[model samples]
Target: MATESARSERAGGVSSLRGLAGGGVFLPGDEEYDRARTTWALAVDLRPAAVAFPTSAAEVAAVVRAAASAGLRVAPVGTGHNAHPLGDLTDSVLLRMSGMSRIDIDPDARRARVEAGALWLPVIEAAAAHGLSALHGSSPDTGVVGYSLGGGVGWYGRALGLAANSVTAVELVTADGSLTRVDAEHEPELFWAVRGGGGANFGVVTTIEFTLYPIETAYAGMLVWDLRDAHRVLSRWARWAADAPDAVTTSYRHLQYPPIPEIPEPFRGRQLVIVDGAVLADDAEAERILAPLRDLGPELDTFGRVPAATLARLHMDPEQPTPGGGQSALLDELPPAAVDRLVEVAGADSGSSLFLAAELRQLGGALGRSQPGAGAVARLDGQFQLITGGMMVGEFAKQTVADCERVVDAMAPYSRGRQYLNFQEEAVDPSTGYDASTWDALLRLRKNADPAGLFQANHEIPHR
Candidate 1:
């Protein structure tokens, strides 16, 4: 429950927001408040004093002003994919941008101007019509703004680099309620920060323009094997991935599919090991590269040529909202011995409490090369990434967190002592994702742009 003084302040804020155009505001007890505050991860419950659904930059500015007038801070969210780190919002106003989804494709220029609320699904479909694709994550439902702003790693990252490198411009509504257009040539400092410094640290992004690739289709799909073959398969995968070309990006996972009506018949209630990825090459070339794995003769093989849009579903990620928790680490290497250790702990025979997935993604190639004028998080320095996650429900949720920590601890010797911001499930030191100089630069930029500390609840960058 809010104190009397806090409630009074929120009531004043709601009054100011009611007069705004191009958007709707919901108060704490309003019928739409709960639905408006709902995020992609159901485990995060945000109880803000008010929620604003802004349809345009002007409307977003109005909401920010309303929050200021009521003596509260503002927290802008797209699909709220990383909401767990946002500790508390009782005195904050959530600027929900889901109502402003829009995408404009300039095929001739090989660029797409995407709205803050838009997901990668529409952008992928639209770009495919022009034989083009964006550097998008595995899940198509993830918000474009948040992903790119946090150094997005996707199926094409090995070849094209992090998604933040592809961003060209951003239209943002800053702290003082001023809408500004920033890029390399305009507000270069702010542009650099917004690219991979995390979007919320600056302001609410209204639109972003990014470079796209000319790719209509790619050789991509998944290969599954029974849990009994985990040791051999995972060890072989590690060796193969070490020498794989830049054109190929791959990940191997140990999955436990629950016996639920929503799950597919083949994967339902089954424990399996799977390898899936994308190859930016012709079918013949892809087969030549994948022949070694094919020789393993897995029980299920679905690898083949597929539309670029289909890459979104290749990882079998949940398409709808689901309650889950996850932890990630960047690894210096994944040798055969390390692979064996992973299998010993999370394999089907291990009786692991984690109920969903544990994965290792091969990373190198273009992702390790620094480009001129790249984002704050220019490139990843590690060779592999380890991710462990499970559904958050009942006692299993507690066990899942502990099991994930144990996995990380077991693999500590191979870890690079670094983490990716987008994959982080809990609040951590901002410096964990960047080097000393980069962290200092980010803090200085944060102090300059958000002096009043408007956006401080979500992955905040501390002021110097």
Candidate 2:
């Protein structure tokens, strides 16, 4: 089915796309083009010259070769959660990888092999079936590959560290259009780069293999308080998290539920404060650890033992795709002044219209320490990852962006001036996501592997 790009001598450099055998291609004028280019972030409008869905490795290779041959860059995406930064895809072939969703669990070895498009939900469930679990983030639908590439911080992050470091091997289609397998032994440097340095700078990853843990369950749930109690709750949580034991990981959030029919009546249009996470300890020990927060008397406390798979949906992130934008910053320990600034910006009386005003995920434990043979992101350099954002589809889009920025900027006094790439939506200096030496190594490797600049990543590591 030749469309505008192919018919017009492959304008935008998407020539010879007919070679994609396993999946289909949608050009600029095709009816499916809009739908194909749509990412999980509906707010991000991506009108690339072409969008290709490749089901197998061979097809990915074909698309890569075709785009490179025609002087087009290939931008591979799964759910497109972080697609906002890949602006102006006029000469880019958007290789949508969702068609290649596949998962294979090796219970004996406690490992799983998943395709680029696989979401964290199925992988979480699969691992749980064998009395194991993967370090998946709050949202189940997040693409595993993209999350890991950007340094994944999940409910288990404090204890287990970032998900990228758990990767064992990666199979990708490189610039030369060759299907290459990289691991600690084979293409070690490339393997290191892909795990945390961002794969888009080198190739379109087809599959990823990662190690799983023997976690069948943990003491996990949420503690909720009325919006009026946000200042107290946040202050208490900030102190508790600073020296919180490594056996637990938690996040504090100020959530404003919308008064929409889709939402349940209990929380509809209600503003509240929430602190939730998992505790990797026995019942008595967990109880002892949570005593300080419990003393504050939350309106709701459901922290108890549950099956590991349940942790995937514990955070209650919107299951479906929604139009939203957010801002995040890595922060040092927050003093009383920082807490005051946060309350001033996003609290109940702050005129903030965001659904999720502010979230501070406790970081330390394994996350603060670099392990042997770690990837590009050796360790998260801050004690807490602060994020604030809201839905942006309606007339409040401008307000939402401004409100989010206000919260982040107000807390700048405590910021580490670093980037947690997974939570960063806007264009930031990529080097902020890494240190000095790691950035230079990744750049040199990218130039050698992709001299012609064949691939485009959301947070691109520029070769030139």
List TM-score per model, in order.
0.96, 0.97
Candidate 2 lDDT by residue in tens digits, 1-464: 44665535557456467547454888888788888889999999998878899999999998888887776789999899888889888778999888888999999999999999999999999899899999899999999999987788988888999999998899999999999999999999998898788888899999999999999989999998888898898888889999989999999988899899987776789998889999999989999999999988998999999998999899988887889888899998888888888888888888998575689999999998999988898799999999988988888788889899889999898986988888998888898898899999999999988988889998989887
* Candidate 1 Cα RMSD (Å): 2.0
TM-score of 2: 0.97
Candidate 1 wrong stretches, greater than 4 Å: 1-15, 21-23
Instruction: Give the Cα error of residue 287 in candidate 1, in Å.
Output: 1.4
Q: What pairs collide in candidate 1?
A: none
lDDT of 1 by residue, 211-245 (tens): 99988889999898998899989878888888899
Task: Go through the candidates in order and give the clash count of each.
Answer: 0, 0
